[model samples]
Target: MTMAQRIGFGTQIRKSPFFDATLRWGATGFSVYNHMYIPRDFGDPVQNYWNLVTAAILCDVAVERQIEITGPDAAQFVQMLTPRDLSQMAVGQCKYVLITNTEGGILNDPIVLRLGKDHFWFSLADSDILLWAQGLAVHSGLDVTICEPDVSPLQLQGPRSGEVMKALFGDSILDLRYFWLRELDLDGIPLVVSRTGWSSELGYELYLCDGTRGDDLWEKIMAAGAPFGLQPGHTSTIRRIEAGLLSYHADMDADTNPYELGLGRLVDLDTDFIGKAALARIRDQGIRRKQVGLVIDGPPLSGPNTVFWTVKKDGASIGTVTSAVYSPRLDQNIALALIAAEHAVLGDRVDILVDDQPARARIVDRPFYDPKKTRPKAELKAG
Candidate 1:
């Protein structure tokens, strides 16, 4: 039997609108994110992983906080926040952006959604980016208002997700292209729906505009998705690891640069931003360590690793495994590791110290499940 600890709830850590619904549906574990409680698991991780891949799953990812930026200079001010050139980003489109410090360190990787000509939302990861944007705006004299709006997001993900969405919102939702969003109204409740998700599966995120209707919205989705084998689930570490998705504060952090994390494409040197100079310098200097994928020779891991497992080369510590899970589909323990650039080449061998015992491992390409990534962006026919 595995020992578990109880998580005490308090006002300091806010609860999502679907908190009660998640509890009633059997949320077995919880974790704190963005000062809010995120449902970590419902039951077995392996079962949840299978469910997400085979059918559909409703996730309470309202822990993804939103920071709204609006005003005349909103576009320019928002552009100053990241190295990505946002000049070509059309309204109703979303871009995965990294908010870096002046030192070129990644502060948070948020989805930048353009809501209107002068309005944008930074759907943040697990960091307090509101203060960072506010502080920057204060000194820059940009005519933009920055604050967290009353918006919360819930994700419906899986192969059958499009069918559930079509059932709930009709055929128009099917027209939404990948990374595009549209304002929607369901039963008089206003929302913003986006074709995006953490899992590399077919998914959509419904951003609840009205917090008071959280329970009602949750029930409505549950009822609509019941016929499609939908279940309440948390984000699966196994699926994410298989997809090579990076979790903030897990695979990378404030001290980690985007280039080292395989996010160099996000940095546009031609466009000036907060970390442009530093990133340019880093690009010129080159990175010493790079994040890479690993396949390990071992039995299934007990659970998701809590700390970085030491990775060694010839008995000397060279790097660490940031995230790892035993992939049932691949039949091997896969991991995302930060290793010396020299050792990050494909097929390079290394040793991973799991539970103090060294296990043989090799460098491999990521997205261990689907290399083509066709599922998430595929068009689904209406049922």
Candidate 2:
């Protein structure tokens, strides 16, 4: 297959809003930014408030959804690839699952949404999860099918997501709960509505059959949300940084296991799954390193990768910051870092390297905020 055909979609269209909004927001332009893939015409703030905070906004996350399973052995074959107990996953339910190599190293982090008894959709990062799953299917000799679904996803995220959705769908959406999804027919087009999102706020995601419905969906959401102060917005990397969400490549990679990324709860080691043995060993023997939140005092003096902890008193570097941001909520610079297992203590002081200078840092409990999941999930979620 040609490279274009291999991508399984049309030529990538960067939402114009990405460049337009960044210039208007008075933030650093994308010229130097390396992480977030923004689109063209990514819109101006209706007022000045972040669009997500005030009203609902839509994002064409077409790049994020990729299906990698097809053929006869797809279903049963892919089950053993992750650490999650897939047998318990109900149809139409979405659960977070990790894709790993046989050695138990992470390959991609994706949400496994069981669409049918034998079909699955894995919304993943910019990784080769599809290829990985195919490799496993060939090795396992299971007669199942796997292939990327021909669908592009759009996200409606914001605090007023419900209000906007109510205006459009007429209150039918308010009943959906977090992680729940339903099929809806709008304008005679089939779409899957899921109360799941990436924004650390109340939101919902919609998966349409293709890009043909993109314009209509966008217009409808905006019109419905007008009364609720909805505004168009794009994904913000900095915001996620403060929210303590892990970015696949930035915060973790193949060598990093879920346990090392503070995702031990998601991995049911007790249940049979790939990587269980390695994780069990790590848990029993104890990890030599751990991921922790860092509270940095003073001005922001370092970027990610700054070492702030050591295994011995100046003996060797144990860990470095994987993610960091100047938090708008706490008005302090907070960071997520991996540190020596022994040094992972609450209120423990460590050293942070800032501008080649060692600065004193302290280990704080994670989340850095929202220790309690206090946000309520309304039925019609938008992100």
Q: What's each prediction's TM-score?
A: 0.98, 0.82
Residue 246, candidate 2: how far off, in angstroms?
A: 1.1
TM-score of 1: 0.98
Candidate 1, residues 215-258: lDDT per residue as tens digits? 99999999999999999999999999999999999998988999
Give one digit per residue, the lDDT tens place, for model 2 in 1-383: 77634543223434322233334434332211112244423433222226665566666565665575544544565567777767777778887778866556687777777777676788887676767766666667577666666666767887777776667666677887788677887776567888877666678888776555566666666677778876565565444665677777667778887777777777777566677788777767766778888887777533334333332225457687777666555767777887777878888777766655566677888777655544425334444
Instruction: Please give me the total number of clashing residue pairs in predicted model 1.
Output: 0
Per-residue error (Å), model 1, residue 42 = 0.7
- Report the Cα lDDT for residue 81, model 1: 93
Candidate 2 accuracy as lDDT: 0.65
Q: Which ten residues in a row have the lowest lDDT in candidate 1?
A: 1-10
Instruction: Report residue 354 deviation for candidate 2 (angstroms).
Output: 3.4
